[model samples]
Target: MKKPSRIVNFLYRLVGMSYVHESVSEVREALAEHSVGTVAERWARIHAQGAEKLQHPLDFQPGLIDLHDEMHDMWRYLVALRNQASRGMSAHLADELEEAADFMGEVLHHVGLAAEATIPDASLDRGPGSTWINIPAPPAL
Candidate 1:
């Protein structure tokens, strides 16, 4: 694969992973900032939303998809930040940090959509296309 393709694949994978991590951490962090009581109430409401979705099929919104993309972008930006930070120059990150921060803002904006369970199969790009199967038959049946 080409370098750009590889990079894009890396970003997509990173985003999926981050989605799971952030979802779980948010509940904890939110509780830390607010109180357990308030967080518990929010959790209950979120659980109800999940149950409703399971009970009804056509109620999904575009916001959830947008949030998925934004969260993915945030993960990509974070990977970029880590790479930039490893370059060993304060000036390097200084230039890239603003963009990363902007991406982080997007993640925060779509915070509620992040899933607390397993990372969904939704990917950043069209995933690898279906592969063909090969069969070997008898030479002369």
Candidate 2:
């Protein structure tokens, strides 16, 4: 995921934003089932929907439904629970997903990392349903 500006990050933190890196169990579950296709859909969403055209449009969200609806339902759970900042991060992810042509490949490459070691790392050991898509943070400026 692209780095959010300091101001945006602060604002997100100020709002207690539990987004982006936060665990969304549905995504993990979809990954468990569809695996590569789950991440592929996110990439496909960027190509088809184009974050530039719509607001926070994501593969897992409610905007465009090109691939499987199962993924959408997974992210939808997070949408229902989190605030707008969370949704905005979905937009951020979608935007970055477009730029990240090999994103799906990366995720799929690391798919066998015992859950905790997955690309977008989240810990099921953390507690009930604790699974996050920890997109790698950008390098230091």
Candidate 3:
């Protein structure tokens, strides 16, 4: 199996964010299945290619930037869930799955929208279903 740090580095490169050392640690501690490697690599390739075309901006899907942001957010939550599992802390796995479902839903929802409809509402939240659980922030951050 690929190590967590490597998986995170791959995601960071794919997600249009500066790669950080901590992301690897976050992955090691947070993720369980760690079977999303293929998807992560594909996303990274898309992101890196998108970034290369930034200067000739007309060819890009303008919402590529927002996609990167959402990707980063997804990684952040996955890392948290992984960490929670590591520490024997209580967590609602259902909520974690719901959050993932919601994020993926939003991504697909906007994929075919008109350019003018691409902007996401700033007040959007990342919790599952309707209820938001208040988990304490990670100590390292």
Candidate 4:
């Protein structure tokens, strides 16, 4: 298997360090505890912090710009959720949060694939039926 690119490896590490999984778990726990008031607050805080922390690194690559923008969108969604929660928990709020999470997950999936893409190396191939050939280097004067 081809090794992941440096960007991909870095992003994976950042994702791990960002406590995304823990935040998700916390949201679930909040739901179980009927603490919907804090759910949006916590979600917004986590994603906003992640976006800020990653902004500089992500800005260094053009290919990463879209992912960075998507992270901002996630923060916006969380803010919307917070607004919805302020009116009291509703099934609609739950559905919206779930949908937002799913979208963010999809974005992360694409980021992983983009980062893991193998760069083509022309030297690795020879024409059909070609035998190995070595060229000697010239001696330095």
- Write the residue-wise lDDT of candidate 3 on 16-134 in tens digits: 86543357566665563343566666766766765564443233344554665676577567666656654655456646655775776566556534332332442473444332333
Clashing pairs counted in every model: 0, 3, 3, 0
- RMSD for all candidates, in order, please: 20.7, 19.8, 16.9, 19.0
Better of 2 and 4 by lDDT: 4
Q: Which residue pairs come into collision in candidate 4?
A: none
Task: Specify the poorest-scoring 10-residue window by lDDT in model 2.
Answer: 56-65
lDDT, candidate 2, 1-141, per-residue tens: 454666898889998983353356755854565646656766666555453443321222222222224444444544443444346667665554444434443443343232233323353345555334333332232
User: Looking at model 1, which ten-residue stretch has the lowest summed lDDT?
Assistant: 132-141
Question: How displaced is residue 103 in candidate 2, in Å?
Answer: 5.5
Q: How would you encode candidate 4's per-residue C-alpha lDDT over 1-141 as one tens digit per residue?
A: 244565876888887743232466666864665545676667767656544543333232334545656775775777677567657677777677767767776776666555333223335645454323232232222
- TM-score order, best first, reads 1, 4, 3, 2
TM-scores of the models, in the given order? Answer: 0.30, 0.17, 0.27, 0.29
Query: Which pairs, if any, clash in model 1?
Result: none
* Top of the candidates by lDDT: 4
Write down the lDDT of every candidate, Cα atoms only: 0.54, 0.45, 0.53, 0.56
Residue 26, candidate 1: C-alpha displacement in angstroms: 17
- Considering summed lDDT, which 10 consecutive residues are worst modelled in model 3? 132-141
Give the Å shift of residue 93 in candidate 2.
1.6
Query: What is the model-wide C-alpha lDDT for candidate 3?
Result: 0.53
For model 2, the stretches where C-alpha displacement exceeds 4 angstroms are 1-23, 36-91, 102-141
